[model samples]
Target chain A: MTQLVRVQSFSVSSDGFGSGEGQSLERPFGSLDPADLHAWAFATASWVGRREPGGSRGLDDYFSRDFSNGIGAEIMGRNKFGPQRGPWQDLSWQGWWGDDPPFHTPVFVLTHHLRPSFSLTDTTFHFLDASPEEALATAKQAANGGDVRIGGGVATVREFLAAGLVDVLHIAVVPITAGRGERLWDSPDELLDRYHLEKVPSVSGVVHHLFWRD
Target chain B: MTQLVRVQSFSVSSDGFGSGEGQSLERPFGSLDPADLHAWAFATASWVGRREPGGSRGLDDYFSRDFSNGIGAEIMGRNKFGPQRGPWQDLSWQGWWGDDPPFHTPVFVLTHHLRPSFSLTDTTFHFLDASPEEALATAKQAANGGDVRIGGGVATVREFLAAGLVDVLHIAVVPITAGRGERLWDSPDELLDRYHLEKVPSVSGVVHHLFWRD
Candidate 1:
């Protein structure tokens, strides 16, 4: 009964360095305020740990609470799952998290390299050596009745979108613009009709935009 | 002395809601693992604030060290600067940062709204009513020979790259792939020649790629 319901995406100022200026191995997130990189901010532990607080409620908080609900399984590309050095050697990396990664369900990792499956706490990392379609099929199986989440780097997301597999997309259009970096939706103007803008108004000036394939 | 550099980019997951599942104002950062999300890890105060510590020295540490160098100004789109709630109310929403922000230098915010200048610390927020070209000119002037960092959401970066105005772009090439959402390089592949891959290696497993536009 698993269904691919939505694909949420937001852009990053790759600079490979992280966030914005002064980007390097040290400040990987860049020099901009963490709040500005709201897309990546949701992945931080500090942000996750504060959600349970009893005294918080606002527009920002509202979006945060809504995004995390009902995720059956997560899918991502190799680059998103770090070490950045190259082919994973022993799978010892286990990601940046220690023993318990935040993704506590079945997480499928898309890669060209094949490696043994790894698991921790409530999450299990399944390395798939197949195309996005194959990966989706496996994720659907694991999702049981939940929706499949498409994790991304850029290339992987494009593959799925080009094939018209994504159902719903939410983009937290942050206010900042990196003058130089990667191009998102660098698609021609003719492709504009492929998706429709569902929402734009949100708190803190962050435009919560949703696009769905027509 | 305006020069062009390469810029790289990728995507992050936000679900249909702007924030990830389980995010709240109290815990705005989200479910990010410090390890998997290496970029943010190097960015935390625990790591970036370590220039005072003279003992650390690894490839990661080296890049981190180089990141703290001198820079003059930051340029970001209106979406990256704050939310899209339209116009300024009393400026109560300074940003997602709590009090002291990260950028101490002058910051140029591109927007169509006419609002008074908002200055904080060494960072003077100037809202540009003109086009991206005009904003870049103003930012370069403020840079004073320093690098003009392009802060972004996505469209902003694409606009600048399309104009051929960047100098260096480093893309972290995260391994994850979102089947949908936004893309980093959805533009014409012909523009690939505009940038040359300066460096490509793995940091922990994450491929650190540097693209320089010559």
Candidate 2:
């Protein structure tokens, strides 16, 4: 049988903008030192190599390593594509990776715009104009037997979650708050009972919470 | 003068069982294969170090190191606290970090239940039975001059975001779709327009999209 799964997600804060204020783009994450957040890095598995002398090691390292398991393809949204507005131009935007991108598998981008197949050194970006269900079907096929992943600009994930399509959620709750902007988890409180807590840890003071269905 | 900021958030896929399956406490992240997901780790600055054969270095290493900046203090919800049901069980649950946790700083937990000023090694877990705003106030004070971080179990971050208290959001768009679970972007579409794209990339196929508001 085909088993579906959801990964982890969390919210980031932004400063409410003033009409006079320009896009400052201040990275509040920069307030702490890279070494200080070693714990969160470990949990998300976003960490790669050692930064300083005693960079990332030990349990943080263990969890960081644990983050990269399992499988298949990925799904994302256009707002996440880049600063570009309107329809996707071409494969020229090969993502933020310089040359050799990370994902070695096929990726499905959820978009309203119709675009042709785009390829990178190790990955292919296929545009999905259909509903999320259609996208999932394609991603699953592309993933083969592995598992289909959902990459989001929020809307995409929300669409799936509303349909009860996610299996697991590993969220790294950062220790920052934005007084304004987009909100996550505004649904009815009854929805809270759908899942149970799996793991919760303060990695380098960053809260890494995991949730799953009973 | 204190400056208020907006919240920027995106969603990512988790394994399955956001918190865990019907509540099976075993392997929360679920059987992960280390080799295939190396890219997911490389993008978020969430991973630690070592494990990969040629391992990871440079910008990939920066992914792990970048998280250690600007955080002064942290606040989290019970969801981010762990799978414990009910509450007030003593200082026994000093959090999953055990003693001498990775976070050598002060951490505040938003909870209905109260516990003594719990201390694990260098980190102190302060349980605040207060609203998100109140928690932010205390966290800011604890943060000194640095930024206050709000760690979440989902609802917590949503609460803050709706209140417009978050400042900077860094999201790593993972490649996976959950056929069922909770969502982060159920908010009205007009609310999300404030955030403009900051960065994006395709590493190992998984696209890492970061967003922020000036």
Q: Which numbered prediction scores highest in TM-score against the true structure? A: 1
Task: Report the TM-score of candidate 1, chain A only.
Answer: 0.77
Residue range B1-214, candidate 2, lDDT tens digits:
2333222222344332122123223332223222333455543323433333332221233334334334567777765555566765655656655556644567888877877776776677888889878888888888777666565545676688777777555444445544444344532232356553433343344433343344
TM-score of each model, paired residue for residue: 0.43, 0.43
In model 1, which regions exceed 4 Å deviation?
Answer: A9-35, A39-56, A187-191, B1-214
Residue A210, model 1: Cα distance from true site in angstroms: 0.9
lDDT of 1 by residue, A1-214 (tens): 2264556545443222113444343343345544556643353222443444232222233334334445678888775565344576765667654577766779888877767878898888888888878888888889877778776645566778787777656555566666543344542232356764434343345555555543
* lDDT of candidate 2 at residue A214, scale 0 to 100: 42
lDDT per residue as tens, model 2, A1-214: 3344555333322221101111122322233222332335633323534233233332233345333334578777764444344666655665543455455678787767767887777778777787877777788888877666665545566678887877656555455443443344542232467764433333255444455564
Off by over 4 Å in 2: A1-214, B1-11, B14-39, B42-55, B58-63, B186-191
Candidate 1 root-mean-square deviation in Å: 22.8
Give the deviation of candidate 2 from the true structure as CA RMSD: 21.0
Candidate 1 lDDT by residue in tens digits, B1-84 = 233322323223222111223334343323433244345325322244344423222223323322322346777777566654
What is model 2's interface RMSD?
A: 15.8
